[model samples]
Target: MTTPPSPPNPKAIIFDLLTGLLDSWTLWDASTPTGTSLEGRKWRKQYLEVTFGSTVYGPGSTYEELVARSAGESGLPNSAPEALLQNWKDLTAWPEVGRVLRALREKGYLLGVVTNCSKKLGHAAVRNAEKAAEGAGEGTWKFDAAVTAEETGWYKPAVQAYHGILPLLGEGVRPEDVLFVAGSAGDVVGATKAGFRVVWNNHVGLERKGDVLPLREGKSLDEALRDFL
Candidate 1:
């Protein structure tokens, strides 16, 4: 006897907007290193590790301000932090990202963008994406809803953030029925524990850790999402 076909998609897919969908690492990499010494590089890396989440979700803190703080703490050149902020404000989505997002929308997925950023920057990222697509003639892109941690008062890797905001996005949607896309290990772990199936968007071949694997992992956004597509 033949088996019945499965449904075409989940109830929705939530994106970890910045690093996950926007490829922040690529841009981060192009910046001049803060220092040449091994200790200095290590220190800068540590600063990034903290700044990525804390600055966004911290009460009254924005990415730009916290990044400058990180630069100072990391002992970087004076000009570095503002340059980083400008790069951030000018962020654009990756080539083909808009097309994929459009495809997902057409496929009937209720899309969401969750980011640890100020409300202004979170929305700015979406608008930036729209501009990027238009400038590249890639086509328009939009999401059904967006959540910023600054508004919610929580950050990723914390279960409260996911469990709290999801209901607001799609009432009655179960975590098991939600798909989350993320690039960082903290994000992967948080999403898994929150009960959403995760796409570990490991676009740079970062070594996977522990045994609790993502529902999928890949070197490109398209590859990480192939299963759903």
Candidate 2:
């Protein structure tokens, strides 16, 4: 069956939904052995082990499930603890990213942040984005809505994550009206499947294969927006 065309001007907003879309490599890079890349995942596993004290595996055994189990186990006061927030807040924007987003926002588009990061990390990233936007002389970029995986109870590649945010948008918005920006192929696929206008921010020059071609592609946030707008 043929797919319908996307709406030209959506009542809804644009979403930069994840660490990749908000923060640059510094926040997500796991090259440092103790960083989230290597240690973050392990930390989550161990945290869950200590908290749950049992091998609690959910469907797909995905990172999102593990994080949920850990949060349930930690019983930590905040949705995201200080340690995680400190680690995540250190992220910065890629070259011209702030400028591009500001340009889009000035065009009267509502900007939102939907991320798979735990609530703490997601909020931290948003704070960083606000700082970057300020530095760019754009004033603080306030998100129309910021939805984290913790709140949604699902992760990217799962339809629920996208569906969960639909109600938060303005009335009369449909999936196609949203521009879902993602750097990872999996995110691109997931957003596309959810009926969004997928914008792949391929910063690292990763190989693209089947299905990757159908969506919009950009090497940086600036490049993506240039084509998108």
Candidate 3:
């Protein structure tokens, strides 16, 4: 009889910041003038398309600028992007985020973040994530390291962007040994192509577009990471 594949044993767990760990979608939606869910999703979808389509990070335009561009494309007023930026600190974690992260930390798995944003926003967002955990009485949730597209000069799925996190995770952590928790369908393909095993926290029920699949997928963080935890 043929042997079944062994389960993944990851040394480190890397996450996609925006949607994976945080309820950034609500904040993004509220940023619009109308503050309607539909408008917010429209803007966010445009933003994702623009950034992911770029492949390489564009130094010419700041991350904030892209937000404004997405607003315009989504038929939102120019004021929409500014509101989003100003309200960034209000981003909260998903219901299962705080608990799951602490569990992983207790298990001694190295934790990190890899996101597509500027260095300033990237770090600040994670700090906000910590505050959300604190509010939930989950204690201080900290990551060992974080990598941003601005730092790598490449957007995710570019391989380089995902690969950039390895050195920061310390020696002996390799792509195959790391488990990437993806927030979006694109990241599933991106992390896998970068050689990391992936688990998708597909909160919004987004469709998977690429050939490569995550080892597991669920609508909640805890559900997706059930086996790993």
Question: By lDDT, who's the top model here?
Answer: 3
lDDT of each: 0.67, 0.58, 0.84
Candidate 1 wrongly placed segments (more than 4 Å): 1-8, 30-48, 51-56, 60-62, 132-140
Residue 37, candidate 2: how far off, in angstroms?
9.8
lDDT of 3 at 104: 85
Q: Between the candidate structures 1 and 3, which one is better when assessed by TM-score?
A: 3
- Cα lDDT tens digits for candidate 2, 1-229: 2222544764454455443455444443342244444544434434424322222223544444454445445443234334444455556767666676677777877677766556765677777776667777844566677776667766665777776777777676678778777666666666777887766777765455444442456777766555455
Tell me each candidate's TM-score: 0.79, 0.70, 0.93
| Total colliding residue pairs, candidate 2 | 1
Q: For candidate 1, lDDT tens digit of each residue in 1-229? A: 1211222467888888766777655445444363233433443455546644562366445655665666677666657665555677767576667767776777888888777666777788867655653554455666777877677766766676676667666677788778888766667777777887888777555565545677677766788789787
- State, as a TM-score between 0 and 1, how close model 2 is to the true structure: 0.70
Instruction: Judge candidate 2 at residue 60 and give its lDDT.
Output: 45
Report the number of the highest-TM-score candidate. Answer: 3
Model 2 segments more than 4 A misplaced = 1-7, 11-13, 17-19, 28-31, 34-86, 209-214
